[model samples]
Target chain A: EPEVTQTPSHQVTQMGQEVILRCVPISNHLYFYWYRQILGQKVEFLVSFYNNEISEKSEIFDDQFSVERPDGSNFTLKIRSTKLEDSAMYFCASSGGWSYNSPLHFGNGTRLTVT
Target chain B: TQLLEQSPQFLSIQEGENLTVYCNSSSVFSSLQWYRQEPGEGPVLLVTVVTGGEVKKLKRLTFQFGDARKDSSLHITAAQPGDTGLYLCAGASIQGAQKLVFGQGTRLTINP
Candidate 1:
């Protein structure tokens, strides 16, 4: 089955440094999302993208965070300056249709470690 | 903001046992989804329940949506050791923004 794919299974960055997490959503998917989970914590929504722009975002998705669909297949999340709290597993997901019924397909995820 | 509260954060049982996990919320949802995640991997979708009082069964697993659409349950029968994993529940509001509100997961371990 087709699946969303994320690069760099694990990353370690220093505080105040920038990091970019990349994802390639399923080719036919129209909606994309970024979510994070601190160890042992609930998965938290960060941002959602559709039509090459941000559709919605959470408080956790502040100015420090940005998402881009620079190409037809690539969706990327950039953090301007990493903070200790930014250390978590970031997941990339996509859905072909409405979330009400269509299930979102998730990538294995990128684990970010900020020191 | 909407929130889902899952019960019995952790469970461990012997093989062939039956167990249930619950997800409850005060806000009604257009749909609810269940996912299973293993260590070092993202959550994999198990099932999606869209209608109130709906029930779906997949093999040894059964899912139910409450009449009010504010609660859901997952029951696993004859669980095996392979059933061990982290189960998560997510809710989508009726307004349909495409964003999901996730609950703290329930971790289950099926000991052989």
Candidate 2:
């Protein structure tokens, strides 16, 4: 099966450092999303990207967060300055449908740790 | 804001047992999805329900969408140890290709 693939399965960075998590969504998928799960907490949405523009974002996706699709298959989430609270599992999802009825496929996620 | 509350946060049952996990929300959804997540891994999509009162079956797992589209349930019959995992329910509204709001999750253990 063609699954979403993420790089650096785990990341550890200094509190003030910047980090970029990468993902390669399925080739046929259109809409892409980024979500995070803090330990023992609900998976929270961070942002959504479609047609090369941001479709939606949550409050948690503040100035520190940014997403880009620099190429055909790559999607990335960059955090300007990592915070302790940023330590979580970051997941990337992709879907082929244009509507809510479409199912989203998720990657294994990158575990981020800020020291 | 949308929220999904899952009941029986943790469950431990023996093999061949039956169990039902619930996912509820106050806001109506255009679609709902169920996933099973293993420890230290991302959630794997099991099924997606689009219409109200829709039912989908996968092997021994059955999923039902609420009549109002605000809730859903997952029933497992004759569950095996392979069924042990964190089950999550998520919903999305119709306004846009908005982000999915996930439930806290139901941790189930099926011991053989």
Which candidate gets the maximum lDDT versus the true structure?
Answer: 1
CA lDDT of each prediction against the hidden true structure: 0.93, 0.92
Share of real contacts kept by model 2? 0.77
TM-score of each: 0.97, 0.96
Off by over 4 Å in 1: none
lDDT by residue for model 2 (A1-115), tens: 8899998899999998999999999999989999999999999999989999998899999999999999888999999999999999999999897676566888999999999
TM-score of 2: 0.96
Candidate by candidate, in order, the iRMS in Å equals 1.5, 1.8
* Error of model 1, residue A113, in angstroms: 0.5
Label model 2 with its docking quality class. medium
Taking the tens digit of each residue's C-alpha lDDT, what string does model 1 give over A20-115? 999999999999999999988999999999898898899999999999999788999999999999999999999987646667889999999999
lDDT of 2 by residue, B1-112 (tens): 8899998899999999999999999999988888899987789889888889999999999999999999999999999999999999988876445478899999999999
